[model samples]
Target: MASDTDIGSPERPTRPGRWRWLPGSRLGRLIIVLNLVGLTILISGALVLNELRRGLVNARIDSLTTQGELLATIIDQAATVGEPEPMMDGAYAAEILQLLSNPRSQRARLFDAEGRLIADSYWVSDRVEWRTLPPARTRGDGPGLDLNLSGGSEDDPDSADAAKAQAALRAEVNTALRGVHWAGLRVGVDGERVVSVSIPIQHVKAVLGVLTLEARDVDEIIAAERAALLPFILIAVAVSLMSSLLLNRLVAHPVRRLARAADRVRLARARAISVPDISRRDDELGDLSRSLEDMTHALSERIDAIERFAADVAHEIRNPLTSLRSAVETLGLVEEPAARDRLMAVLQNDVQRLDRLVTDISNASRLDAELSREAPTPVDLRRLISDVVSLYQATARLGEPAVTFTAPEGLETVMVSGQEGALGQVLRNLIDNARSFSAPDGVVRVALGRQKGQALIMVDDDGPGIPPENLENIFERFYTSRPKGTAFGGNSGLGLSIARQIILAHDGTVRAENRRRDTSTEGDAPEAAGDIAGARFTVILPEARR
Candidate 1:
């Protein structure tokens, strides 16, 4: 139930709330998370920028290669004719520059046989420095273009030049140079790729002079690519940072807080999980935190109960030891032989009582220890109860009480998993103990049935009921209703304790409390008011391995 005060208004708190995040701890996580995110963003951006630059460089190389080949073919036609020299006058260089300045061609250059740059479209001057380029070769053609001598080949030129180093290319070109056709060649710049083509001057298919074509518009290609990469890398870094922080808030922080809370709980600094909710958003972490908090609280209560029980057990055993030792000493000091015999008999009984107490203590302590070693095997619980009730049938009939076993309709072969001997002993103890306390001609009923996944065995007795205060402790080791020397009815105080241990070993539980007459019996309200009711022992065991 929630109180009116617990219900809240729509308004939010004005000042800072008693912090949801851990003080002095969240700062470190924040610093680490942000630093890691920043590093990732920076590295990713650099890699993306590098890839964009590489792609742009590759595209520019292809464009430059094609433009250079076309420029070489145009230059070769103008220079190859000996009768009229357009290239020799050098005035047509401006017209060549204008042609090469087209935006589609991304590079431009003119080279002589000595690998000297004769002109450049971007330089804008005929007096531009003739830059030296790395040695290159021009392809050759057939020997049909010479007009000077009868048997002279057009390849035997008069000029002795460095371009003669291209002898391999010359042999290939000689096959095609006898007729007008294209001659492919390359001239290496410092680092850039330059495509160029050659044409023959001496004959329709013989090499005499070379003309090369190139481009000068490479800057636009590089600039356009850089423009997209710059913004793309910047935006990617921003998104990575935001996503990392969001993930920490939604996922990492809650898990870390739960682990820290568990550590504090192990040290007993906190009774339950006291960490605040880091995630206010309705999501999976919210449900996990709630579930964990509930489990921690329940576990803490169970542990506290076990500790208190241990203290009670220790206190209960001390009184029995002191009584046993005092009785032995008193018997030794007696004088008369007849009196001595009587005292010895009394001492022997006390000794047996102490022995029973110690045995019960040892057995109860090891209940869980034994169960953890192995799982119980399946056995017929119906036969076990019948055997136990039959064993106690003579004692039960001493007072002429009615001892009846009522199992559910298909229970003759009902099976559950457990230690057969221990389980049978528990049933026998429950039945025998109930019989001893019942009124003459009263009914002691034993019932077995399957409910859900558990085997429920119940024993009901007609007798003076247990007091409410002692009901919970009756199954504890060494606990008994009768004081020592009450001969009317007192036991070794072991029957119920042993029964509980056996049940627990099977991973089950046994509880004893007064049975309400209205619920358990026909036409009887006496037990309902706590006066003439009987005690009921209910045992719950796992049916699959029960």
Candidate 2:
């Protein structure tokens, strides 16, 4: 139930779960997933490119090993100088190296058994120097080693490893001198990678010279590999950007607008809720917009009903208040005892009327809340009508109207689903209304029957029939069509209206119509053929499921 403070007011406080931050928002989470997917795609592409690079370099190294073997065989026959030390014929080997080289791709070189350079395709030299003077360096007192100033400190691990690596020709020649072929990837001093292969020229265990093949364009190969990955990179970037834009336009912006609209509702600047244009879409956001609008509209209607009910309550209470005030004022002015007694009676009646009106108004106002709190259950119309009529019979006076109940023959039960307490009150109200209209010796009969899959309850009174025009008006609030000589303020005039409201809430119908006399003839209107005998009220309710 809404509190008095919240009723009919736009300033009612909202719950705390509405304000969420960016990462908690729907769009933020979507963007996070998109970015994660893009990162996965990028990492997967990099891994693929890395594997491709390794395969290409390994294949190149194998190719160089094969080529080096072929060149070593050729050099063994061509290199025939210095038999004791096994030197290479510089001119013949140089020609072979030049023929084997593929310009900037692979380099071919020949080294003597003594690990001296014999020929090089890059140098184009017929005969390379067998020995060269060492570079000038400062003497270190700690050891006999010389530190070349231009080559950096000899103690530096990077420099020392780089210097050892730069002697690729000597390392291959030394390995080949041991009569073993060497081929694999090696890092150059400049941090570039190369595929190197070295093989020795030998004739029956007599080593001649070493032939080495090195592919120095590994950087270009890596560059090509990266170039091949460009498409995947571009696609990942495009998808990320597209997803961001789509989320912002379709989700984030609309949600933000909804938040702003909710803020406006919180501020109570407007009675209606309005979201963004996204409500036009046929999606979840649109559903949310429609639901919010409907909720606000319902609240506004409830507030209006409350305001009207309050006004009606004030008006109803004022009439009796005005009477009570007038009676009290006149009681003091009246000097005669009989007139004073009349004034006192008037005051008492007004007070009682005020109390009755207040009680009925309270019940009518709380009807909605009370009905909502109570769950509906199957109510046997026969039993219910019997109980209400028995109560009225017990309370009936000697000269008052007598109440009786009748049910369909052989019909064991006619049940409808509703709050039994509320429906019982409905019965009491209808019976009381019927008794009030009936003559002193008249009968108020209640009947229960089933018709068209519905439970029907009819209350009949042997009294003057309702006016044709007031048949409908009789069910309206504050509408009373009492007979002459009846005590004023006897009825609060809300019983019928409250009854109708409760029946409607239970998905039932109630209406007032006059019963026709037995003299009515066929093919003639009831009023034209026979006079109206008495008033009859029929209540219809859906039969309860078995």
State the lDDT of candidate 1 residue by residue for 1-546, as single tens digits: 111122222342223333335222343345446656676777677656654565555555555546654655555555444554333323354366555654545334343333233554545634333444433435663333332211112123332332242343343234323434343333223222333333333333334333333332334454565676668766766676666566656566566666666656766778877656543547777777677778887788767866875776666666656766776787778888998887666667667766765666666666656655656778788888887777667554455667788887756667778778778878878977787677677888999888888889999998777887888788865567853335421365667977987887677899988875544455645545435478898999887632
Across 1-546, the per-residue lDDT of candidate 2 in tens digits comes to: 222221233455633332233343455456756676777877687967675577778888888887778777777777666645565676787777776645467777677666656666656635332423345556762343223211222122235545555565456668888999888777654566768888888876877767777887878867776788778777877777667767767776677666666656766777767764766789998998888888888888888978887887788889999998898888889999999999888888888888889889989989999999998888887887777888888877899999888886898888888899999999989988998898899998998888889988899998888998999999888788888987778788899999999999999999999987778677987567677779999999999988
Off by over 4 Å in 2: 1-233, 255-268, 274-280, 374-418, 449-453, 526-529, 543-546
The candidate 1 region of ten consecutive residues with least summed lDDT is: 147-156
Q: Total backbone clashes of model 1?
A: 25
| lDDT agreement with native, every candidate | 0.59, 0.76
Worst 10 residues of 2 by lDDT: 148-157
Clash totals in order = 25, 0
Clashing pairs for model 2 are none
Candidate 1 runs further than 4 Å off = 1-54, 65-97, 110-119, 123-273, 276-307, 329-341, 369-447, 452-454, 460-479, 482-536, 541-546
lDDT of 1 at 477: 51
Each candidate structure's TM-score, on Cα atoms with residue i matched to residue i, is 0.57, 0.63
Determine the C-alpha RMSD for candidate 1 after optimal superposition of all C-alphas.
12.3
